[model samples]
Target: MAVNLPLPIPENLTAVAGIELGHAEAGIRKADRKDLLVMKLAPTATVAGVFTKNRFCAAPVQLCKEHLAGLRPGAPIRALVVNTGNANAGTGESGLAKAKETCAALADLLGCAPTQILPFSTGVILEPLPVDRLVAGLPKAISNLKTDNWHNAALSIMTTDTQPKAASSKVTINGQTITLTGISKGAGMIKPNMATMLGFLATDAKVAQPVLDRLVKDVADRSFNCITIDGDTSTNDSFIVIATGTAAVEVNAIDTPEYKALFAAVQALAQALAQMIVRDGEGATKFITVTVEEGRNVEECRKIAYSIAHSPLVKTAFFASDPNLGRILAAIGYAGVDDLDVTQLNLYLDDVWVAKNGGRNPDYQEADGQRVMKQSEITIRVRLGRGDAVSTIWTCDLSHEYVTINADYRS
Candidate 1:
């Protein structure tokens, strides 16, 4: 059971023009399950991506970076190959060889250069990818490609996610309506400094490669990078954006109205996907948002927000619906802000003021805190009475099911 998360409604997903997706049942780690996904892009599509900062990133991640760098001005990405059940990380030379071979195989079938194909993998780390199974499954995925397969594509890339994560939106740019659709998969190991997760977004509006590169980083910083689960970064985190120049709209300048609308729509979709990941977190019962305001800088505010979000004590209190203000205060105090003034800080759970001036509020009531804590979703707001900086992080409450899920993950 996935806490309060609901299965995504398939009818709500809009298909992006110039993109086709398909899935196949590959026995990579399990038999008779859809574990492989292939996404085909139009030849005019330009792509950009952000990857995990973890030094032990998967072999596919390394290959994706290399391929993206080798892309020529006129040669755009043609295909994306994804597999679940084996992460293909920490397998040394063989893992790199397998990842490359997969790309070569995909490119051969699609009649494009190997660098035009991007390969992605997610599952257990430190495991060798079953290349034979993946290669054999490619033809079926390629043969079944269709423009309206976003729903199944979301399901195919999932590892432990209880439900598929997908979002879509349409915006008018230059008197033309452009469609944007995206899907993400993750359940745990989700502190992204790029998640053990994969996100793919595609838009039909025309965009330059350099602009796409900058847009991906900026959107990710405001979306995927603002979430945490268990405070562990994965070895296979990847978020990719594709612009298929199929629409009549062209966004060549970043300072134009078209760019702002496109950026806002994409960022909102990404944030929705990111929030879904936390809501479906393994053994999570409550979705939590930690907001830190009035700091000297955004970085310091983010530090304090994450400090509170990643605290096991605070998470446990959230799980139990216990108003343990001391734990939250402790996390904020040790958040490495040397100049923080305890007396000038305030804490609130939803609309109830729980703490003021480094202690409990005189008018605070336990019942009020309990009422907000009992909800499936809650927000923690902290005021620092400093500058105007603010930061918000989305997280989930820790529970025993989290331990159980990871303890027997391999079995």
Candidate 2:
């Protein structure tokens, strides 16, 4: 059961003007499943991406950075190949070779340079990518390419995700309507330093490559970077944004109205996708939002927020819907904010004041705390009487099913 997550409707997923997507049953790690996806981009399209900071990042991630660095102004990214169920990570030299081979295979079929193609993989770590099966399926994916295949593309990227995560929005900039649609897949090993899992967002709006690069980092900071699940970052996390340059409006200036509108739309879509990852977290039964405020700086607030969000004690209490709210305080105390003053802190579950001035509030009731905990969606707010900085993170409650899921993950 995936908390309150629901599959996205195919009809509502609009297609970007210069992007075509397709998927195939590659039989890479599983039988009768769509585990391969290929995306073809227009010659005018430009791409920007942010990858995981994990030291042991997948081979595809390293290759993606190298390939993106080789991107020049006129030579746009031609194709993107992705495979699920075998993260090309921890295989060392062999993994790098396989990732390059996958790119070369796709580039050969597309008649483009190997450096023009970006490769991505996700799933079990320390496993070799079955490049043979993946390469054999490229022709079928190419044959199936279509502009309206976003729904199937989303489904094809799944690893342990119970449902496909996707979102779409339209923004009018300078009288031109630009469509932004994206899909993300993540269920566990999530705690993204840059992005939780694999996310690809495409738009038809024209933007300069430099601006696009800056925009991706900004968008990720406010969206994908704000989410976490289980506090373990994956080796294959990637968030990529593509600008197809099909819209009539050109977003060259950050100060322009068009740029602001486009940025907001993209950030909103990314946030929606990030939240979906938490809602669909493996065996998750509750969605939690931890908000920390009045810190000396945004970084400190984020540390405190993550401390609470990542605490197994706090998450288990959320799972049981128990009023053992003190665990949240314990997390805050140990959050490494050396100067944090407990006497000036306040805690609330939704609107109910759970703690004040470093102790249980006199008016706080266990029933009220339990009431908020029982809800499928919950907000835990903490206010520190310091500065004005604040940070919020999305996560899910720890449950027995989470343990069971990971225990049998390889099976």
lDDT of 1 by residue, 1-411 (tens): 665667878888998989999999989999988899999999989999999999998999999999999998767889999999999999899999999999999999999988899999999999889999999999999989999999999999989888899989999877899999999999899896967678999999999888899899999999999999899999999999999999998988788898899899899999989988999899999999999999999999999999999999999999999987789999999999999998999999999999998789999999999999999999999999999999999999999999999998999
- Looking at candidate 1, the ten consecutive residues that score lowest on lDDT are 1-10
As a TM-score, model 1 comes out at: 0.99
The per-candidate count of clashes, in order, stands at 0, 0
Q: Write the per-residue lDDT of candidate 2 for residues 1-411, one digit (tens) a residue.
A: 777877799999999999999899999999999999999999989899999999998999999999999888666789999999999999999999999999999999999999999999998999888999999999999999999999999999998899899888998887878999999999888896854499999999998888899899999998889988899988889999999999897988788887888899999999999999999998899999999999889999999999999999999999999999999999999999999999999999999999999899999999999999999999999999899999998999999999999999999
lDDT of each structure? 0.92, 0.92
lDDT of 2 at 142: 95
Positional deviation of 299 in candidate 1, in angstroms?
0.2
Instruction: Look at candidate 2 and tell me the lDDT of residue 22.
Output: 89
Predictions: Cα RMSD each: 0.9, 0.9
